[model samples]
Target: MAEWVPVFRGEELPPGLMRVVTIGDQRILVANVEGTFYAIGAVCTHTEGYLDEGYIEDRTVVCPIHFSRFSLISGEVVEGPAEEPEPTYPVEVRNGIVYVQR
Candidate 1:
């Protein structure tokens, strides 16, 4: 069964901002693009850098260590040094709260 965990409220993450939260053993990176929310793996596949500490450009999250860019929505490796794509979680806004489907 899939579990939905509430991470934050809709107003907590503004446009072009990223938030990091650890749930159990999973480190989640939540990004706000325009007004939509996207959740992905926090650790960069290149160097284990935190994606939340990196910059947000368009729909891509760049790694702070190696400048590898990953798509926030699809979790694809858009830029290199990181060949593998990160895992992404489905996000849903319900009653003004942001929930991550796991």
Candidate 2:
């Protein structure tokens, strides 16, 4: 089974905000959508642009490079130049902290 590592506290992330964190060699983007947390791959599939630098619009994360948009909740490539969906990590909330399964 994968281990869940603490990424950030729920209070640290407000709604419509994102934080990029690296656990070991894995880079993940943690987003807060109205007190709910979602974790997704930090790198864009197209050119490895940082998704954290991208804008969040209505639950979709748009890549700054080629304007590829991905669903933050589902990791689906809603629009692309990106042919593959970004990987999503499982998130758990405990004691107002956010942990990600990696």
The local distance difference test score of each candidate is 0.93, 0.91
Query: lDDT by residue for model 1 over 1-102, one digit each (tens)?
Result: 899999989998899899998877999999999999999999998899998889999899999999999999899999999999999999999999999988
TM-scores for all candidates: the values are 0.97, 0.96
**After superposition, which runs of candidate 1 have C-alpha atoms over 4 Å from their true positions?**
none
The TM-score, computed over Cα atoms with residue i paired to residue i, of candidate 2 is 0.96
Clashing pairs in 1: none
Compared with the true structure, model 1 gives a TM-score of 0.97
Angstrom error of the Cα, residue 40, model 1: value is 0.5
lDDT for 85 in candidate 1 is 98
Compared with the true structure, what per-residue lDDT tens digits does model 2 show for residues 1-91? 7999998788988999998989999899998887778899999999999999988988888898999999989999999899999999999
TM-score top scorer: 1
